[model samples]
Target: MPVPVVSVAQMRQWEQASWSAGRTEAAVIARVGACLAAWLRRHVPHNDRILILAGKGHNGDDARAALPHLQGRAVDLVEVRDPETALPDLERALARGPDWILDGLFGIGLNRPLAEPWCRLIERINQARSRIVSVDVPSGLDADTGRPWGATLRATCTLTLAAPKQGLLHPAAHTFTGRLEVIPDIGLVPCPIQSELCWTLPEDFLDWPPPRPVAAHKGTFGHLAIVAGSTGYHGAAVLAARAAQRARPGLITLITPASVYAVVASQLQAVMVHPWSAAHPLPGRYTALLFGPGLAAADLPAEIPATLARLWQEANVPIVVDASALDHVPRGPIPRDALRVLTPHPGEAARLLGTTTNEVQSNRVAAVRALSGQFGGAWIVLKGYQTLIGRQHGPIFVNPSGNPDLAQGGSGDVLAGYLAGLCAQPPLQGDPERLIRYAVWQHGAAADALSRRHPAWVVEDLVRTLGRVAPHRVASTARPATPTTPP
Candidate 1:
């Protein structure tokens, strides 16, 4: 089943539904506790002493409910109602140094700052040597923005309840939320609430570039022209071209400067190369134009902006602007309703949105949408901890795949290539929005697949692993193969 993502208000509505359906809030809490207990018993090993910090709210009730279910495992339960004496067990756990500390003090509904003893306990938990597993959310941390009040507990693993809270993906929450695990509580199944934020999975990316016809020739697979690389940054172009080539065969033609043509050509086998004089615009002769990745920062002979403007005016296809190209392009009302795909990281997004990096980070959702409007792209993918995909008119989809391992350099280049391949695929229902969603989902799915096998993933490895990432396909006779006859 697709993962359910919801905001705090939505979660409340669901909780209300659960209560109205004759299931008490305590029953829902017990269901959550049971899931936590079962997981701990299976993975956490026996004799692993657990110190659970319980608060006054339902989140604290969840901790207390899980205590009896610990069975023979040693449990130290602390009730945090006041500052000094409220967290005795938590303090003792910190002082004695337990193996794992469970934070069940607060959930996503926390709006106010943490007070005294709880704040002190959270600080000690942060400074502790033991691994912490926060239930629902880490104490002292805001579930929406991941901002910590006063002090917050840094957990090694967090078991989010029902749905993944928005805070878990926040930059400030990354260190605290080491490995996020979402668990489904059966008792909450009857809840009538719907989700506002959803974790996109491979299943959600159906009906993208429709299934290909076996009888189709190379031309059927849309052609992609890549304008990348310069004298110094050939690897970026090579990576992008190779990734795109691997994604769709025989449809990619990478155009680069004459100086590095041999270097880029030698490195790639699947993608064709066009060596143009560094002084000319890429000949208008393909389905899409992918620019950036190894594009020189130094002044080009014809000037890249003018060349891009010409391409936009002449070329009647989608154009993906990234990296250095984004740096050069002037921001204003778009020229036409071109199928433009902009791939920018946080810093780049900040520049494109005319705001500081901090402002972009503060509200990533707002920044991406605003930039998409400014650029008039059919799709925009803003890469970050929670990668966001923006369509011309639709809800923003947040990617659940990838980890801190993807934070390395050259990752964005690989993504640019992936998007190109997806854009080249014929739409399932001739809808461009579906293609954008599928492409974003597939890009993350590829990373997710790699991370499963290699937790410590690198950008080069991700680029090389593109072939292993499968596309959405359905069995049908409508696209059957046909034999070619020699005339």
Candidate 2:
């Protein structure tokens, strides 16, 4: 199982438990520091200069603990005993201008904002020209709320101890946390004591979507029906088809408006293309369905949602509702066993929930949970930074993949298609929540890898990258992975 979220109170309880088990604080700090030092050695050059900003808290102790392992590097320390008196020491260290600055001023124990000289000290650190790496939680960030309490300093990277802090995974915390990497085996186990979120890990790729039988036929993986497209938005359907194709679905049937069908058909080779017809809105049997990519409300008939809902009344398959289709999700009671997955960005989520976009983004975890309850999607994927995927009656997952690369035009369409394609694959459809998590992770991971080659990528680049992360894990084959530590 993926690691669950942990709050400061839970962390304290864990500390007490570990203490009862004869695990001392000094020993745990040493282990955490050693693990971080190992990771730094792998990521940082040996010759680079390092400067440590030590504080009076445990965060500072953790940073100072690593000093022994970083022997060969040019290192210096600025101990902050009294910020008012330590300004001279801090200035002298900052003037040296080391290549990397380790901010170890505070951790999850902090509940109030930084006061007086502490705030000025952090501000001065932020002004320095070196890359900053925070030891755990940033100096002034609220570990539980995932917000800057006050006077927060931004970091180039955050080398966290044990499991990652839940606040660090917040969408709003990225600016302060930078690239995050967890230092493991320090004895902090974030069990299911109290948390609604779990972090998706790379190991999830194993044993999922199972493996190809080698003698498999086209019908083995099941059929995917993608209903999308309009006149000017024909490319949306093509992108969805391309993504689904890369996802390795056995057969793809793309249904588009007749006026745009020719354009979409010309852009694909394997996908079977069809035109929208009121007489038979949805035609054959399908294992899964993807709907609403680039569908223009002006183009679709007023009664299209009702007609499609009536046609799919008895179907017991998973459906990915995305883009404009979110507005037309079939009304009335859904089929007993049918799985409905809704993918909505903040704006679309706001429209569906009858709330403002700010309200949804402010507390994405709450918004996602509310979405599943109000909208009734078996899986609700709230798409944004640190995308949150919520199951109707299960715990939500926080996906830690992708970057700014996914803020493009057709990326949502690709993700929607990928979700449907994964659902179509047999054996893997048994676990609905895990399947959605896998799909969302792979989608962002594709963006993370492709973004390296180009500063910005078209949705097509993401579609092609899906082939690399596709779920086809066999007994002996391991899927390729990009380390969480940024290169």
Name the top TM-score candidate. Answer: 2
TM-score list, all predictions: 0.78, 0.88
* Worst window of 10 by summed lDDT in candidate 2: 474-483
How far out, in Å, is residue 87 in model 2? 3.3
Clashes of each: 0, 0
Runs in model 1 lying further than 4 Å from the true structure: 1-7, 21-27, 34-56, 61-99, 109-113, 144-146, 164-203, 206-220, 277-285, 297-304, 328-338, 391-393, 428-434, 441-457, 467-487
Estimate the Cα RMSD of every predicted model relative to the unseen true structure: 8.7, 4.3
The alpha-carbon lDDT assigned to residue 67 of candidate 1 equals 69
Full-model lDDT, candidate 2: 0.77
Model 1: how far is 380 from its true place, Å?
Answer: 2.1
